[model samples]
Target: MFPSKSDFLLRLTTCLLSWVSALILVLIVWFLFVESELVWREVGVLRFLTDDRWSPSGDFSSAQFGLFPMIVASLLLAVGSILLAAPIGVGAALFAAYYAPRGVRQIFPRIVELLGGIPSVVYGLWGLVVLVPLISAYHPPGTSLLAGIVVVAIMILPTVALLTLSTFQQLPTSLIHSAAALGIAPTGIVRSVILPASRSGIMTAVLLAVTRAVGETMAVLMVCGNVIQAPSSPFSPVRTLTANIALEMAYAMQSHRSALFATGLALMLVVTLLVLIAEQQRGKAGHV
Candidate 1:
C-alpha cells in the first residue's frame, strides 16, 4: 500500500529534525575540542587530569590548570544528589502511579512538571536565601558541598519522579493481573514484579537525573561556596567544573581561556558518558 502524503511529510520532517540536532551536537563538541587544544598541549594530559592545583594567573610558568578538585567536587555533587533524591523521587512516583486518587495524581504530576519548568536561577536564589541560611544555622558557612548536594537534589527531583512515574505506569497490565490472580498483595506485586520489570527505566531515570545534577551551574554555584579545594567532607566547601567555568570565563585570557574550554570539554565527556549509559538502559528496558 502506498503511504499517504501527510505520513511522508511527517517522516521527512522528523528525520530532518533529528539530523539537525545531531549536527548541532557535533559542532559543539568540535568547537570545544578545537578551542581547548592549546591547554592540552601546554599542560599535558597527565598533569591536567591528576594535578590538584587550579591557579591560572601570574606567569604561565607558575600557573596550574589541574582539574582534580573540580572533578572530585562534580562527582560528589552528582552522587550525593542522586543518593538523596532517588529514593524520595521513586517513592513519590510509586504513590502517583498506584496509590494516589485520580485528581491527586493529576495535580501532583502537574506540580512536578512545573518544578521542572522553573528557571535554574530562581532555584539558585531560593537556595541562597532559604536553604543556605537554614543550613548555616546548624552547620556554619552553609554554602558547602552539602548545600550544593541538597540544592541539586531538589533541582533534579521532578525529572526523576516524572520519569519513574511514567515507567511505573507503563508496566504491562497482564503482569499485574497475573500477580493478582496468584493472590499477590499490592505491596508484594510492586516489590517483586513491577519494580523488577521497571529496573532499567529506574536506572535510566537516575542516570538522567545525575547528568542534570552534574551539569547544573547557577544553583550549585550559589550554594557550593565556589572554593577551589577538594572537599574532604559534606560540610566542606568545594567547586565543580561547571562552577569553575562560569566563575572565571568572563575575566580569563590566552591559555586561561583555553583551559576553561578544556574544562568544558571534560564536562561534556562526563555528560556524554552518562547519556550513553541512560540510552543503554533505555535499550534494555525496551527489550524487556
Candidate 2:
C-alpha cells in the first residue's frame, strides 16, 4: 500500500512537471505577442511585412522593422544546410538500417551518437579554426555564406541521421520482403518500397535539420560574416536572425531591443508553423 501511494505521488509529480513546462512555453508565446504590439504600432502591420528597409536607427519616429532580409537570410542558410545534410544523413541511415555489417553498424552508430553529444561551442571552435580557413580559399573570404552553410550542415547531420535510423529500425522486415517478393531489384526495392514507406520520417528529419539550422547561433556566427546585407551568392557573407540576435543582444536598447524580440517572435512563428505541417504530414502517413 505504501509503494502504491508512492507511485501515485510520483506519477502526479510528473504530470505537474509536464504542465509546468507547457505553461512556460505558453508564457513565452504570450510575451512575444505582447512585445510585438510595439512594432505593430510603430510600423503598422502591412508596412512591417512588405517594406524591405530596417531603419531602427533612423530619425523617423516610427523606425522601419521589415524582417524580410533576416527572413531571407534564415531561409537561405536553413535551405543550404538541409541540402548539404539530408542526402548524406539519409544515406547513412539506410546503410545503417539495411546494409551495414553488425560490427560496422555498432561502431558507426556509437560514433554518430558521440557527435550528437558534443557541445555546439566545440563545433563553433572547429569551424573557426578549421572550416573557416578551408572555405576561404574558394570563397575568398573565410566568413562567407558557404562557411556558415557547411558548418550548420555538419552540426545537424547527426540529428537527422539518428532520427532516420530509428525510423527505419521501427519498420517491419516484411515490408522490405514484400518488395523483394514482387521480383524487384534490391536498389529498386530501396527506392520504391523503403523510400516511400519512410517519407514521413524523412520529412521529419528535414524539418528537424531546418529547425536546428535556423536556431543555430554559435557555429553560424563563427563562420558567417555577420554582415546585414542580403547575400548575392553562397560566396557572400550573410547574417541570419539568430546571428543578429547573438551579436547584438548584449547592448540593444529601447526600440532596438524590441526589434530583436520581434525577430525572435518571427522565428518562433515560422518554426511553430513548420512543426505543425510536419505533424499533419505524420498523420497522413498513419493513414497510408
Candidate 3:
C-alpha cells in the first residue's frame, strides 16, 4: 500500500508540473495585455498600427507610436536573412549528413555547434568590427538593412544547419538504397529521396530560424543602423522593432512605455504562432 501511494504521489507531481507550465503561459499573456491597455486606450488600435511618424517633439503626449514601419523592417530583415542562410545552411547540413568524409564531417559539425554556443554579444562585437568596415567601404554610413540581414544570417546559420542535419539523419536508409538501386545518381537520390522525405523538417527549421532572426536584438542592434525611418533600399539605414524598444524604453514615459510593451506583446504573438505552426508540422510528419 505504501509503494502504491508513492507511485500515485509521483504521478500527481508530474501532472501538477504540466499544469503549472500552462498556468505560467497564461499569466504571461495576461501581464502583457494588461500592461498594453494604456497604449490601446490612448492611441486607439488602428492609429497605433497605421501611424508612421514615431518621433515626439515638444510634448511627449503627442508622440507617435506607429509600428507599421518597424514591423515591415523586421519582416524584411527576417526574410532576407532566411533567404541568405537557408540555402547555405541546408546545403552544408546535407553534405555533412550524406556526403562528407567521415573525419571532416564529424569535426565540422562540432565546430558549427561550438559557434552556436558562443554568446550573442561576441557575435555583435565581431559584426561591429568586421561588418561595419566592410559595409562602409561600399555604402557611405555603414549601418543598413543589408548589414543587419547579413549579420543575422550568420548568427542563425548554426541553428538552421544543426536542425537540417538532424532531419537528414532521421531519413530512412531504405529510400536512399532504393534510389541507388534504380541507377540514380547521388545528386538525383538526394534531390528525389532525401529532400522529399525531409520537407516537413526543413520547413520546421526555417520557421524556427526565422523566429530566432526576428527576435534577435544584440547582434542586430550592433549591425542595423537604428534609424526610425523605413529603408529606401537594402543599403539604407533601418530599425527593427526589438531594437526600437531597447533604445527607447529607458527614457519612455507613461503611454510611451505602454506602447513599447505593446510591441513586445506583438512580438510574442508572432513567435507563439510560429511555434504552433512548427509543432503542427512536426505532428503531421510523425503521423506520416
**Model 2 misplaced regions, further than 4 Å:** 1-15, 49-62, 286-288
Compared to the true structure, candidate 3 yields what TM-score?
0.93
Candidate 3 per-residue lDDT, tens place, 84-140, comes to 999999998988988889998989789899988888888888888998889989876
Clashing pairs in 2: none
Task: Count the clashes in each prediction.
Answer: 0, 0, 0
Using lDDT as the yardstick, the better of models 1 and 2 is 1
TM-score of candidate 1 on Cα atoms, chains taken together: 0.91
Q: Cα RMSD (Å) per model?
A: 3.0, 2.7, 2.2
Across 71-169, the per-residue lDDT of candidate 1 in tens digits comes to 889998999999999999999999998899999988999999999999999888998899888988998788999989998999999989999999988
lDDT of 2: 0.81
Kindly indicate the candidate among 1 and 3 with the higher lDDT: 1
Leading candidate by TM-score: 3
Cα lDDT listed for each candidate: 0.89, 0.81, 0.85
* Candidate 3 off by > 4 Å: 1-4, 56-61, 286-288
TM-score of each: 0.91, 0.89, 0.93
